[model samples]
Target: MMSVTRPYQLTDLSDLMALSATTNCADPRAAYGWLQERWGRVAPVELEPGVPAWLVMGHQEICRIVRNEQLFSRNPHNWRLYNEGAVSPDSGLGPMMFPRDNAYFADGDKHRRLRAPLDDGLAGLDKQRMSRLIRTTCAELIDRFADRGRADLVNDYAAIIPMLAIAGLFGLGPEKRHELQRGLLALFGSGSDSQAGNETVERILTEAIRERRAEPRDDLTTAFISHSNLANDYEIQQSMVLMISAGYETTKTWIAQTLRLMLTDTRFAGRVRGGRMGVDDALDDVLWRDPPMANMPARYALADCEISGQHIRRGDALILGFAAANADSRVHTEDPWLEVGNRAHLAWSAGPHSCPAHRPGRLITRIAVDTALHRLHDVILEIPADQVRVAPSPWTRCPHRLPVSFTSAGAS
Candidate 1:
């Protein structure tokens, strides 16, 4: 398909068949940079595809589309492209969130109903309980390599915390625990090769759902199934999908990127360590500077809408760049491109689907960050970042390996 462009450019629309064509999951930002270069202003620009669609980029525009449920919808196109194949009429994921059919997909009440149980599960911080678990995990990991002076930050440390925390929440066992940490990394991680891995990962989750049903245990999975009033097995499967997607990918990226950012900008790192930049500023800085997911795909139009002066045909798929929009200066007076964080940005999202679990997610992030701030005496990059390996996926960014050295640890 040909790349989409504004009417001013004399490009052939026939070349751009649909939204999927321009998007290369391997390196999405490349195409984003290309499109941004083609048309000016980071506002939601149409990619001039065979099918009429608009990608909301600027901060305000993304906010507009996500909030305007009346006009924009998650199931915009009749067809959605996935790794295996294209799903139409039905989401292929089956009667789940963002249903393809208009009535089910567009109904706000339905969305709220589904989120109710999920919301309840997210409640109850139990800071004392959770903090103890997090610190212990970090301490154990640090002990393993304290003398080695080298560890892969993502695998050896950061990635393990969420799963362990999530495991405690779910009460998963060590045997056949089915670690979502690595699974999600592969699913949304780099390379087309992951398609096969994604399939296997989904299958494992599917099997776990089945086993949990027959022999329900005292865990988050059992709690979710019983609490959700789920219609059938597929819905149960979707919960696993949502939890893994929400809990794993984003958290991993944030940790990897945050450490890297602090490495490059020690001044900022010093501020965080000294309790000067403080928690809110430090977290906000990373949220603005290194958001996990850059853009989210497959938003349906609830009704025909116009954004940034373009007439979007109803039901047309709208692509949104959470990172780009958050970084756009139009919505923020401060120079966002400079990676400054005096102002907040929309990394997770800003509208109805703006991430209901964001509050808890932030708490978990705090545990990790605080562990580093108060525990590790100083920052040490074992494998100079230039030598550290990078994962190839484009939609989300994370370091495959962040070898590092740190002083003997202590607790806050």
Candidate 2:
């Protein structure tokens, strides 16, 4: 531990790297390595420009912070900068970092209370029905471009399937589903349109809640509206927001990343095509190497403490470095044989706030990947892997586009 502990001054801002830039870089692992070498496990970083926070990179250190709620809380209300009125409502971080009524921003009993509706709503999901919905959505999406013999998988396929399937569960029609998808993409992009996007999402979800209350149906929206744990309309809407945004972004990224891996890495491509390794193996491998939610925001320190020799002040924000922790050399190795079937990565996160939708997320990703690979013969990236661009955001590391060419019956 390098015991350096004092409040950061404005002058210190020049030295801190923006967290978003690191993850958006060509080699994030190298960026993480540079941070670790310079500042040990916990390194100082900026969310935007002067908005400072610590990015926790060590696997053990992250486990400690997440597992002990007493020391670190998920509620963003504890964030010093936000409480100090430093973060503007119009800031790009608003959609992601601001406090909300959902479980993602609550702590203790309230967290469990808000989380129940999501847990129950998802648990009540008809797995077979959901799978069928996903498969059907996949086929429909592929048919749109299958005839052209080429497609941008990220936009045309990976991005659309998750939202469409999720909307199907909400019993939304095509118009509303498309509306919801557009809103969420802008919201997660965390750009100038984020606030507007958020408003659109809230409005759509609010309408769903109102309809469900008036005439309940056999859908997740109705299930959420009727869940015993949800107390009021606000809670219900926020819960849906959390479920849809989190599920859509993460699952979309998982599918894109897995496809990228299978298409780029001959180890996976040959094995998967040869029946030596399963698609599940490739999915699991992506979780370890490139999790959808590369850096999760965030946990606030409840009390001043020391971690990895750095003095963490009370109310300081700590971003969970999932991608970095997954690469922790102490827990991971370069040996490909040893990595197969390994489920030790922090991609799904850990502790109470760990992703509750893992089963459904995996189910969705697996079906989407399997269906695409099987249907699109000889699918291959149109550009070099290094040329692929990732969407710019403070939290997730998703590809912006994945253009590919393949053989189809309609291609003459």
Give the alpha-carbon lDDT of every model: 0.59, 0.85
Relative to the true structure, candidate 1 reaches a TM of 0.73
Model 2, span 205-264: residue lDDT tens: 889888888999878899988988988888777777778777888999999988888877
Instruction: Give the least accurate 10-residue stretch of model 1, judged by summed lDDT.
Output: 76-85
- lDDT (Cα) of model 2: 0.85
Instruction: Quote the lDDT for 122 in model 2.
Output: 86
TM-score of each: 0.73, 0.91
Residue lDDT tens for model 1, 293-397: 665554665555556655555455566776666656665654545545445477777666666667656767777766665666665887665665456443456
